[model samples]
Target: MRLKNCLFIGCLSLMSLPALAETVNNLFQVREPVSGQTPDEKTRATQAALETLVTRLTGDAKAAQGATLAEVRKDPQQIISQYGYDAGPPESLQVDFDPASTERALRQAGLALWGSNRPVIMAWWLNDATDGANLVGDGQSSAEPLRRAAQHRGLPLRLPLADLGEQSIGNAKTLDGTDVAPLKQASERYGPDAILAVHAQENGSQWQGKWHLWLGDKMEQGSASGASAAELADAVLLSVSQRLAPRFVVKPGASSSMALEVQGMTLERYAQLVRLLEPFGGRLRSVNGDRVVFDVSGSVDQLRSQLSLARLQEVPAGEVGAAPVDAGQTPAVEAKPGSTNVSLPAGTADQTLHLRW
Candidate 1:
């Protein structure tokens, strides 16, 4: 199925720490429609934005009804860091919250924190409208509902171009089948982590949709019916989020430290590596030449799995010996004294990683 090579574009950009840090910092922002700049209007807008932020972070629609939300409502300013108005005839208010405080609030309420480094999904939508069967693509009106749903769920989605390459195999009949080769081929340019093939039909006032989700080697298919296109989009997004939430949700685990050795690392690569590890909440203990030590807050296996998702290839044990060090150049090798060594299976070694530029 050639699934192993399907790399999302966002994962490729994780090497840029400053850009990612900014994204994480602004992850909790929300905008609400406002009529006037009155005190009452601003307060209501802030509450609405807060509700949306809570739902977006937790991936749970009911998150705003919890005890933590009540705590937040008591003094919204405690968590909200900034607010501004958007210029419009019907103006809107934008609110930004303190990320640390908001995340702490979610943790205190026993909620899961879905990180901002989300996977991008490529959607192949075929609509059987009253006129005829047509493929939906970027900038098309039919794709608007799906885009809105993705924005609301904090999911990055790319619609197909339906050009000659896509049109050759993206017909409604082929999309209905289980074979993913065509979709996979068409999705190469987008570099999505997952692909969604959606077939929708409208009959009278009702909209019916059949969706197939391709996540790595796993495939899941389902059907949904809604009264309107917007409603159907919501249903599809809900199903997608339900399946993806577990993979992205950060679970609390025992804290552990590990020493990672990377060969052929330059100054820029080292900085990128450190930035990639920032989202894991790890503390950098030391950097001895090529070796970097971290006091991380999760199990070694879990960290390894996360790194694998980020495309860090593990070095085989057979090639794990010390590399040649230049004279007067400190070799990055071995953990510090008193540091614990983590053991893993032959093929699943996590102590050493090979950096591919």
Candidate 2:
């Protein structure tokens, strides 16, 4: 009887397990540069901020222009929790959207949403300037623009220390090559879920970058140009956000019911798993010893991605096989006296997935 039923309170509609990925905060807050403090300027910038927020939450570049969100675009102020201007070298207006209101509005519009529980990215950026080439370290002046852009794009970006050893590893060949072994080896200390390498150079007044990203077995490459380093960083990070969204985003009308059974379940792990599966609508079925069963709704891929964040490994077929459990139906687990195994009904393996942490 090591398992216990747990209560779960849903937070933002995002999926990142506590131990596996970093939980990003202030996702609903957005800041956009403004020309002046006039009412008209504020309105315009606020509207722009709303568009940026929508793009960040949805991970679609053109989502701001979708017809479904026309009403939200018309009255963006309804979701604003608070807004004000920041005084600085380049002034900006900051808007904080109400989480509950924003989530409701987006769901009502039938739009797919990406959660704030996202993977942390390690950025290995090399800036080739007229003076000399340098690596953007975590504590260097060159890192500010990248940090700002990462925050704006809702990416959890990390920078390397750029010591002599790391600088030797950050050469042009390592940054631009198809082989990621060298960069991956260098990023071992950073503990990021993904790695991004950028080879940027100053061409007269404009900055151009050729960037490559590696996550798991997949890789993405693109190029961007901007008038300044900040703009270039923003463009590159925006592209990264767009590329990463589809793998984790859950669409409104694209879900199916499935049964999930996890071994090594405890009360604490049960609570954590519940939060991780919030977006999938996980409902508990039964708890026996260190095992627990849950009925959840979502694609198998989505559920697999969510569970992986908690370091859960899927058991191979025919190894602790599962029987399908319908919606609102309890899984049939037969417990016999003095037996450690709970038997599952036969011939329903395809509809259920078995995993262990």
Candidate 3:
């Protein structure tokens, strides 16, 4: 009997299977998919996935927070309107999503939200944000992702070239001289109204950020933090739009420049953004959000002439060419120098300078 038992053990050993086979078998062990997980699980997963996608695509921090997965699927507009946010165009939003995100949403979130008549841009920011595992990561230190996000319309606030140029550097350096005054001038030039300013601060544990909407110099809208650059943009738009409805109006008026800082690519892209404004006779100048504050003076005609003299007309489009605007067309506006600041109003807007985000 003992000999027979040994023989049996030997036979069992002879039929040995690889450990990897067991691992694969474990992987294939489908335990009924956790009951009603097919639909419900898909819903949760999609909502979680969509939160990142929308932020990356439209730079709105209040994407899913404004609408449930069900609400978003039925009608994103309902979500947009209810939340009072503008993503510009669906195609622009679509361009920022990752292909995998699009596929996952289609499979899980249903056709309502995922299926839209929009073109996708495959922005790296959207791709990274949609990756669920990375949702909690900090993006303030990242460059390419934010740049692509802003380009794809994921960012709501637009930065002038001068301000943008100041953002792209290794450290928080200040700008000086006439070279830095025009950007600040633009900000002051903005018509007395509410605006959004993005603030990124390192808080040891995580980044402290909020999309605050300003009215004159006071904060009119709410705040939302713990978001990506794209999400912050979206949140800013929602909060500002909602708040603006009560405090301001969207009129065809002039805007000076938008200022932003993202650890990098600001300086390099500043010229690019300046070029975008130059067409409207806007000029780029020193716009460091810290220290060395300055003022600027110039008119739309002056900026255009400067571009012309710089031979920007001959330079390729989408770049800040080196040309001086015709002195004759230049406006009498002057750039003043001062200190940089970040302050929001208390309640009213009379003498306040509200800082959003």
Clashes of each: 1, 0, 37
What is the C-alpha local distance difference test score of each model?
A: 0.64, 0.79, 0.28
Candidate 1 runs further than 4 Å off: 1-26, 31-51, 73-78, 81-95, 253-275, 284-295, 299-305, 313-357
lDDT tens digits by residue: candidate 3, 1-357:
332232223323322321100111111011111223345654443344355545333234454464335545553233221111123332111212344444444334322221111111111111123222121112343433344333333222223223333333111121111122232334443321223344444444333443333332244434553444444544434444334322211112332333211111122222232222222332222222311111212333333322222223222333212221222221211111111222212111111111111
**Candidate 3, run of 10 with poorest lDDT:** 20-29
Q: How well does each candidate superpose onto the true structure, as a TM-score?
A: 0.69, 0.85, 0.26
**Candidates 1 and 3: which is better by lDDT?**
1
Worst 10 residues of 1 by lDDT: 1-10
Candidates by TM-score, descending order? 2, 1, 3
> Over the stretch 1-357, how does candidate 1's per-residue lDDT look in tens digits?
111111111223434433211123346777677988999999999888877787778777777788756878777898888999987433789888898998888788777676675656788888887888878879788788787667656677889877767766778887798999988977887877788988889999998999998866678889988998877886887678666655555555543444444454444444444454654554334334444444444455545544544445666666655542122222221122222333222121234333332
Report the C-alpha displacement of residue 208, candidate 1, in angstroms: 2.6
Model 2 residue runs over 4 Å out of place are: 5-19, 265-272, 322-350
67: Cα error in model 2, Å = 1.6
- For residues 127-180, could you state the per-residue lDDT of candidate 2 as single tens digits? 998999999999999999998899999999999999999999998889988788
- Model 2's alpha-carbon lDDT is 0.79
Question: What TM-score would candidate 1 get against the native?
Answer: 0.69
* Residue 162 lDDT (model 2): 97
